[model samples]
Target chain A: MPTSLAPVSIDELKAIAKRIRAHIVEMVYEAQSGHPGGSLSAVELGVALYWNHLRVDPANPDDPDRDRFILSKGHATPFYYAVLAERGYFSTELLKGFRKLGSPLQGHPSMKALPGVEMSGGSLGQGLSFAIGHALAGRLEGREFRCWVMLGDGELNEGQVWEAAMAVPHFGLGERVIALVDRNGIQNDGFADQIMRTNPPAMFAGFGWKVIECDGHDMAAVDAALAEAERPDERPRVVVAHTVKGKGVSFMENNPGFHGKAPTREQVELALTEIAEGLA
Target chain B: MTQAASAAATREAYPYALIELVEQGVDVVAIDADLSVSTMGYQFGEKYPERWYTVGVAEQNMVGIAAGLAACGKTAFIASFAVFLPGRCFDQLRTSVAQPRGGLNVKCVASHGGITVGEDGMSAQAIEDLALATSLVPFDVVVPADFESAKQAIVAVGKTTRPAYVRTGRPKVPAVYGPDYRFELGKATVLRTGTDVTLVACGVMVRAALEAAELLAGEGVSARVLDMATVKPVDRESVIAAARETGAVVTAEEHQTTGGLGTAVARVLAETVPVPMSFVGVDRYGTSGKWDELLTYFDLTPARVAAAAREAISRKR
Candidate 1:
């Protein structure tokens, strides 16, 4: 599993998040096909989990007892790939090959294609159930490994999500499972609220889950919410991190146009410059 | 033909085998999306509560959870009516289970396969389940003819690491094989051999085919019988050899004529030896009735198989 707690400071995490944002921009720009808006929206959430909370080891990716992170909102592959690469699961150079043939970095996260990926997910609302499988198996095996899954707020439109939401607490798996929702408020067609208004906090709480809402772009708040998730409780925890559609880049922030579109070369340069300014 | 004087439901045999696997120390977990009584999966749950999960009436969630369990190193056996599995959760099965290369060790053994589900009506009968399951890559699809083969097939799939889909029926079928019969994943068992024509069948139709061979024998036509228990990764060599030797082939199943055993056999024959062929299966949706009544209603009887076999033989060049 993990060797020890994250040794990096808050400043280091911010720096890492900035670099991750840069990688996401460049990866989508090169692949010319990926979901960059959701990718950017989930950068800080990815950083907080990979750097501060999850008990995963890059070297021993297949360790049975390691904590698992499933991207339920799997369209955010650029974000997931950047996080895995930043965590030393694979080389950052491979980021250039995202969405290409023979590249381990598929447009969607595939478990067999990459070592760090815990589940193959592109179809939304299914990852949480898959995460539940890991948690149920851990309990059966008498292992203490925890499972973390990230879900998109708009992806809640799928009824299967509610099915899993109802199952986690029913199984008494609250102690070993945690879910993070990226409430970016923007789906592909339009704003999430305008498309399908599923109040995640109320919905999850009604399903008997412990809900934690935070500013997803704020690294410290994301870290704090994750820390709270680690506290012992009788209900499974959900950190509803409020995020922007295309965070970091000023032109794309809260813009649904960039949801699944790649940034042009000029847009990439501008996005990188904006990200570097955030680093400062 | 040897009548064993005993019969059992394939659905009943499935859970019996699951209990055996657990007793034999196979680390398997069973999941059902309600209908446990019909699928007979509740027996496994009642026996081993720790290793069983019933995910309400949600088939999609059940499939995803099963894939997850298998991915985490448990031989997860998810059960439901055949109509609910591939019928309601094809996307989950595709992305979560089958799309993964070398598939997860998940065994989807759905009961109530084909029109043999009987009184439940057309909605419950899964005529195209074999087509949906066999369409996936690296999935071992098997349809056991009788209780003994169903028992052995479940245990056989549990022992292997590959993903598989085994379709079983709700009705008590006549015994086609005894305790000495071994169930292999991709091998066809030749129940009887002859040179005039071949009768290939699966599930309850295997019994019908055997009876049909006897009828053909009475008419002075030497007919061969092959029990095609495994539909996907189908025994191509056996099918080709039968076609090459007999020059006529008639496939029988308690399923749709469009897909199921007929389409699988046609693919092999069309690629290898082109032979005169006919299919004796349900060509339309079925209605609510008794199991035997539906069999006659769909023309899935021994007489139908005999007539189809003769039709194929008459067309042989």
Candidate 2:
């Protein structure tokens, strides 16, 4: 069982987000293969969940009663792995092993390989269903622990995501499962709007989810959206955290090219400097 | 020789197995993809309404939800047509269930396996399910030959911790085993003993193999009949023994010759004792016809098996 830590201040969380962003830039740069833009965009959301909201113990990750978090948008693994490491699930030093051979931290999150990883993911549109599974299982076991899953805006293009979207509410797990869509508009090819247009808020609402919108990078807003998810409702809740694709680094910000490509070593140095200065 | 009074469909035994599992105080959950009636999931659903979930034509979600339920400590049994469950939702099975390495206890009970699905034709028949399922490293594949074995397989999955894929047929085939029959995972049951050739079969074709062995006995050819129900982690000991003892092998199934029981046996024989072998299965897609007619059309009959067995024997060194 994880002992509850004292509540972390929003400012402290913001500082932590900056550090997570720096780590993300460095890890992706060292591997020379990863998605940095989406990882940077999800920094604050991951920070908020791991630092303050999620009820999990790094030591006892398999605790049946612990809250579950699944990175359904698995390409943004730098954000997910950084948060787990920062939360003390594993060594922060292992971040350098991202996508390397024999590393537990693969390009995608693998539940079997990593301890804190609640589910293995890489293929999009599959995470929500996994979260629904955990939520339903929790309900069956009469456990109060909630399940939180994150989805990429472009990943919603998968028909399976909507299949899970329809199932969550039909199963009446509104109160138990909370979904977050990193509403970063860029995809691998180009802008999500240019490739495929999906109005997430309206679509989730249409699928019977209680929809909430927040500025993903804003610490307070992200926290508030997650707090609102705590309320027990008959319908599942979805937080559409609108954010920039490349949030911290000026060069990568809103850039589709950074969606999957890693930054050069010099670019990493500049991005680190920009993230460090952003804390000021 | 006497046969049982009536044939039993392994599909019919599925519901009763679920009822028994629930009565045994097993913490089981059943999930279906709108094919609950055809898959017989309604039997468990009616008895344990709270534990049953109908995912409504979404086989992918059905499999994913079942993986989740299994992850959270419920023994989840997911049911759909054999083709759709393993064929459509294979990724979920690979990543969420099998790859997790005992993280989830999900039983994939796929009904209507192989060309025996009858008039529904090639589209509905899961002739290659065994091959698809066996490809997954951690999944245990079982094609129960009769109602008793199907019931036992379900109960075994409930008690075990690993992920399993149990294939059941739509048609009612003759009962191959009695109530006293025990199902050991990854082990083959040798129904008859012989010396000249071996006939290995699974699912509906187990009966055909037995009849083929009898037909071979009339021609002074001693044929061995081994029912290899578990296809994934195949019973190597039995398969090797049959190969070494018989010198020739004939594998039969109500599936494609490439990836089902035939391939499983061939793999074992190729790696261990190389032998002259023939396969009695559908090498091509089946057409719309009566179940028995389709079997004949595919050359999956006792006559075919007997002929294959003779050919295999003649080719022996």
Candidate 3:
């Protein structure tokens, strides 16, 4: 049994990632309207952060010193909800109610609707700025809480994201904030390069952020990168996690059609079976 | 009416009021989009450097950051030109600020609210801000009538947990409220009372409504002047009562004829009393000129308000 203070091993983290992917497919299949591709792409990143680094207590979620995790790419709520539940923030029973009326499980993460959500997010590119706010407030109050925000590679197209990228270093809040970018390489319309070539590592470096490139699916590499990110630095860090769009499922890999489309009954069975086999 | 002794821009009182909030032991954080000087946010920044943030001309980022700060249990106040606030970052306000049920104590105080932002051309003016702000769910919109009211309005919103939008103007205007006057969030102040016509006005137009009431008095037309400081959740009881008593109504504002104070008052009147009404506001885009000159050019004047009152009263029979 992994205690709260005990570190989760890389193999256990990988097993947890597979379960998260399975939950994503099942939840999206239940909702019949959710973004599965981005959610699947970010499963490993969520697992690594929640299982290893975040100093959060599910019983006392409103702890002022607890590290905040913002889903900047808000459409990936299934990934966020799964990880949060697995961490004991809420019961996994809520997963079936994703995007349903009067459910805490909204299509996008609503901070007010759930106990552990750090931001009420849906419209893209605003989450990083909000993370900066959390960091700034923590700095002023002399709190050591860190802010970890996850961003979609496709969401880098928004001008507001760049604005936040520029302001974090100027405020000297670089060390207090960590941005995780899931480089899925596919947006809603087509390939991310065709929509906008945001070479994130180069772009974030230009904005004076410390950039780290890692293979997202590899649990050990992601854990190592996150650990390295916690090292004292004068600049904000961006971990560009290179990931397949529809990770863990064969047919949906790098497929743009699965970006926001619901999987058919047969596809759901196949995807869940594939995710379950990954755990085996 | 309070003595119009000296004139001061409503924007001048904003920063001082922000400082007062901190002095009162509120955890206040202020952010500006590189318009601290123009928006008068520099005074607060000067006093509280630790809690001040300048986002360097990025209005969208300023709003998003303000939401984040508010989420962390701070009363985050964001300021910019009225155009840039609801103008440039409407989506940020809708999603990040207004949509949050909890952790949404963001006070978006926009300076240069209307066509009074003259000499800077149409781009700087925010004639539709009140409309845009009032459209959002649970946003308490306050358009202060003068310097005293502006300060009091800021302090009122600073002390509350609800998300609010308070608008201030660039040009200096005569003081309408005294130092002792208290500003309620969703209530209107009756500046003058009469029986024939009720003139409802907001922001700088409250003074115009008062002046119109005086003019109407001269022509044997008794006009009731209502200072509708809060544009959203507009003083419905006052509006309904005035419509029922006066039988005629005229709405005045330094905003567009559509979806402003006029629209707010009209909704109340149509629902309850259904009085004859006329709207006195700008229907065309503003042109470059002096601040007061633009008010006259856009027909947002005392004479125009008085004329609108006569039209509504004439149609009452």
Q: Is candidate 2 or candidate 3 better by TM-score?
A: 3
Show where candidate 2 strays beyond 4 Å: A1-6, B1-4
Model 1 chain B worst lDDT window (10 residues): B1-10
Q: Which of the CAPRI classes, incorrect, acceptable, medium or high, describes model 2?
A: medium
Stretches > 4 Å off in candidate 3: A1-5, B1-5
Give the per-residue lDDT of model 3 (tens digit) for B99-206.
887439999999998999999999888888988999888788999988989998999999999899999999888888776788898999988998999999998899
Taking all chains together, each candidate's TM-score versus the true structure is 0.98, 0.97, 0.97
| Candidate 1 lDDT, B29-90, residue by residue in tens | 99999899888888888889899999999999998889888988899999989999888998
Ten-residue region with minimum lDDT total, candidate 3 chain A: A1-10
lDDT of 3 by residue, A114-166 (tens): 88998888899999999998888888888888899999999999999999999
Model 3 steric clash pairs: none
Model 1 score (lDDT):
0.90
lDDT: which candidate is best?
Answer: 1
- Candidate 1 or 3, higher DockQ? 3
DockQ of each: 0.79, 0.73, 0.83
Please, what are the lDDT tens digits per residue for candidate 2 over residues A1-280? 4435467899899989988998899899889999999999998888988877898988888999998898899889999899889889999999999999999999988875888887878878888898888888888778888889899999999988999999888878887789999999998899999999989999999999889999998899998888888777877899999999889899999999999998988898898899989932
Query: Clash pairs of candidate 2?
Result: A174-A235, A174-A236
Worst 10 residues of 3 chain B by lDDT: B1-10
RMSD of each: 1.5, 1.8, 1.9
